[model samples]
Target: MQTYNAPLRDMRFVLHELHGLDALTSLPYFADLNAETVDLVLEEASRIATEVLLPLNASGDAEGCIVENGVVRTPKGFREAYDVFRDGGWNALAGDPDYGGQGLPESVNKLVEEMICAANLSFGLYPGLTHGAVMALSAYGSSELKDLYLPKMIDGIWSGAMCLTESQCGTDLGLLRTRAVPQEDGSYLLTGSKIFISAGEHDLTENIIHLVLARLPDAPPGIKGISLFLAPKFLPKPDGSVGPRNGILCTGLEHKMGLKASATCQISFDDAQAWLVGAPHKGMQSMFVMMNEERLGVGIQGLGVASAAYQSAVSYAKDRLQGRSLSGTKRPDLAADPIIVHPDVRRMLMTMRTTAEGCRAVGIWVAQAVDLSKHANTEGERKEAADFVALMTPVVKALFTDLGFEAASLGVQVYGGHGYIREHGVEQYVRDARIAMLYEGTNGIQALDLVGRKMPAHMGRYLRRLFHPISNFIEAHRKHEAVAGMVEQLERAFGALQLATGQIAQAGLKDPEEAGAAATDYLRLLGLVAMGYMFVRSAVIASERLAGNTDEPEFYRAKLASARFFIDRTLPQATALFLAIKSGKASMMALEEAAF
Candidate 1:
């Protein structure tokens, strides 16, 4: 089995070395978060991943969950493991301190999240959804709601779920049938069925808080009528004791292909006592506040799935002796040499490693941005960091998950026949990763948001937002002999992006599908460039760190080599994407609706 601990050295390199964590560490909010402290956190998280979570991964996959007597039974050891997670304060790493949370920076929390998810993504979804619910309630709920909920939630005593998808609607809220009738005291009576509600019903927590979205009776038509509500399994009373069970019930669970251990429930809310989250009409705004993390969380879902798949595949490749070495077998005593001896296997392993490194680097940078944007002293600095994260969130979610699924598939390929077998675990990973692309606003929607809403948010500020950092990196490292070619590659990719922008802007005006059809590929290209930049930056930092005569010179060297691998193999895809976008929407519009 593979360990899912965050690569602490790589995380630090991406943070202090590449993304400037020191600047935030000096801030009051992040004052205690230096490299040493951060490493301690990662080390502890690693211990949890190695000790608690990974063990149940295969067990949960095989045993899955069984629902009987109106209760869902988690796989063996999950309840006990969750207890350790709570006892260690892992659940509240970045939570506010007022509610018994440790109040660490989100940057640290993100690293921890990566580790936890990698260890056992199915198990991790329970708390991951809880964290999202907490964020929504903390940010948008009233004081009464916070006092009632935050402590238990932050303490990891109560878990949570998101109720958005229905049979008729997934992303299109306007088409949803979930209904909420306004009550006299400002609460609402929610009645509807929500499907695909992950962690919707479980034994892990005392109470499950559901953040449901529904349409009001006299509400304006479409999404404007949509509202957010807090409908718990059991309403929390004023004295903090659990009230009678609310009107919500778990109708059934979805037998998903992936994340089988994580229950995907179809919930029924029959005039449930629901508290409004934010104002009725502005629920979408409040939802968007959480989407950044949720989407990024989905990105982390990608990171988690990919890291596990890659790490496991790497181990498998090393131990599985299948073929003679390309250099003529030194292992002549054995029938065949390890697969890693071949350049192509080496290439596959390196691709996974490089992608993992890139995603970690970019995710950490995004995490740091989220922290700085919240705490930066100067408005300009705050806005810049905020813009950076906002621009990158959709790309991270779409690209990471898309690539994560692809990487899982590749891992299976690397394992040959064993990979396809359920016993090996790689096939399960592929199944688990498949859903991440569809959820969290779906990759297609994410791509459209990138090219449509987010791209134009600042009138090209987002593109400039990316370019400023690229320019700075280029100027700062132009003289460095090892990295100049990589920078030139990024420059070429950036030019490709520019031409893409021009071509799309022109064609989109004439035919919107021109942008729509190419949006998915275009987003991947941007993610490649963006992740490539982070990889190169990380490599540069790792090299500089190596110059200090460290005990781990090879680790840094490996990272630099991985960066080179991405440049050689991956960035060229962007060029093809650029030409495809330039080819216009004609291919996409080859025939009208009846052509098929």
Candidate 2:
């Protein structure tokens, strides 16, 4: 059987020990928050995740969602689970205070999100998309629109969905054929079809607000002409009550490989009543606000499943009797030693454990930057924070999800043949984790964005946000005795990253294909270095704690062990990536197009 306990101890290590809550509470927006309050919030969220969501995960996947007579019904127990999630104010944890929210920091909220995703990823999609929509609307929607929609959406009375992909276009929005016509009442009529829309239509909420992208009749061709619009399943009256059904309809539901309980719909809009969001033809700009947030959330989805998978794998390793340990029959009381006694099994478990811990540290670091980006006191401080967030966004999304998939696969390996079947539930993690790499703009796109866009933006201002700190850390700790060895490893990886960045910059100027070819490997290199940096920092803290008397010595010792494993085993990948990146696009693009 699969089991997950929210890893609250590790979470506390990340929040209170590793990253420090003071970094956030010092900000005016999060001034009222303290360690005790945050702990309470996390404890409550853990209860809901373990109690309400976990039991329904496999059952939901088994039953999936159904579309009947144009109505979509979620799997059994989902509706009630969603109610428990919403009624407890989980939906409003990180929402805008002006719009009926608790106004918590993203740093805290993201940890809560990880627990929810771990317990039930499919269920997380419902409110996850809503939070993204809320962000876009809050950032770009007009005041009148905000007054009418933000409250109910934040309150979880109504859900939200993003409608960007048409059947014709997925990554390339320029190919979209969705059309919007202006009406005399300042509303637009949207007519088109969208596929792969998560939580697009579901019985969990009374209404679903869609943030859609469409082109005006006179709009210029391609992506530049695209505009975002707000369309709802049910239009609202002046009294904030549901009024009438809009033109939007659920055409079909996708038969996906995983996340079966999350409604992935094919939607049709026949002259859907909608209001414009942001300025005309600036849809991508407004929608990116939501897209970026979703990207981060999707990354968490990967971490969530990986964390759950790792826990299950560890449990199986300890209990399942396998070949005797090569060193000795450690478990002679049993017929065979527990698999965990074997070095090979230890390797897999260590890899999974290190990946989860490393990703969690990086996630929290970026999450802190997110809060600072919006609420810092000085413009300079905010700009720096925003730059850090922008640079690390792709890294977090790509690295977490990629490692997440690997961790899930390793879980299966730990379970051996039993994992391949659905009986043990590890296979479901592998299937579910596969989608995180493909969706939210796919891991490949994330790499390209990191290398092509973020690396070159504003003469590399965004790059400085990450590069400078790593550089500073290397110089500061190169000779420190406590963590000198770990710092050396980080420095080598950081050196490789620096060289790769420069090579991509200089080479791509001559041939963009060079950058494109190097993008994925370069992203991984950078991501590994970022994780190394976190691990080294963690090692420093753990070292200090262990040098003195501590209440929980094991936790700090384990932290140091994971950090060492990441540096020793994982960070070396950065060197291989650098070499691959230096090889350039010659061989990559050399093959003839018709060869296949």
Among the numbered candidates, top lDDT falls to 2
**lDDT value for candidate 2?**
0.93
The segments of candidate 2 whose C-alpha lies over 4 angstroms from its true place after superposition are: none
User: Residue 476 in model 1: shift from native, Å?
Assistant: 3.5
- Tens-place lDDT per residue, model 2, 1-596, is 78899999999989999888898888888889999999999999999999999999999999999999778999999999999999999999999999999999998999999999999999999999999999999999999999999999999999999999987799999999999999999999999999999999999988999999999999999989999999999999889999899999998999999999999999999999999999999999999999999999988988898899999999999999988889888977899998999988989999999888888999999999999999989999999999998998988888899999999999999999999999789899988999999888989999999988999999999999888988998899888888999998898898899999999999999999899999999988988898899899999999999999989899999989999999999899999999999999989888899996
lDDT of 2 at 378: 95
Best-fitting candidate, measured by TM-score? Answer: 2
Q: How close to the true structure is residue 387 of candidate 1, measured as C-alpha lDDT?
A: 91
For 85-147, candidate 1 gives per-residue lDDT tens digits of 998888788888888788777777887888887888898888888887888888899998898
Could you tell me the lDDT of residue 23 within candidate 2? 85
- For all candidates in order, the CA lDDT equals 0.83, 0.93
| Cand. 2 TM to true fold | 0.99
Q: After superposition, how far is residue 581 of candidate 1 from its true place, in Å?
A: 1.1
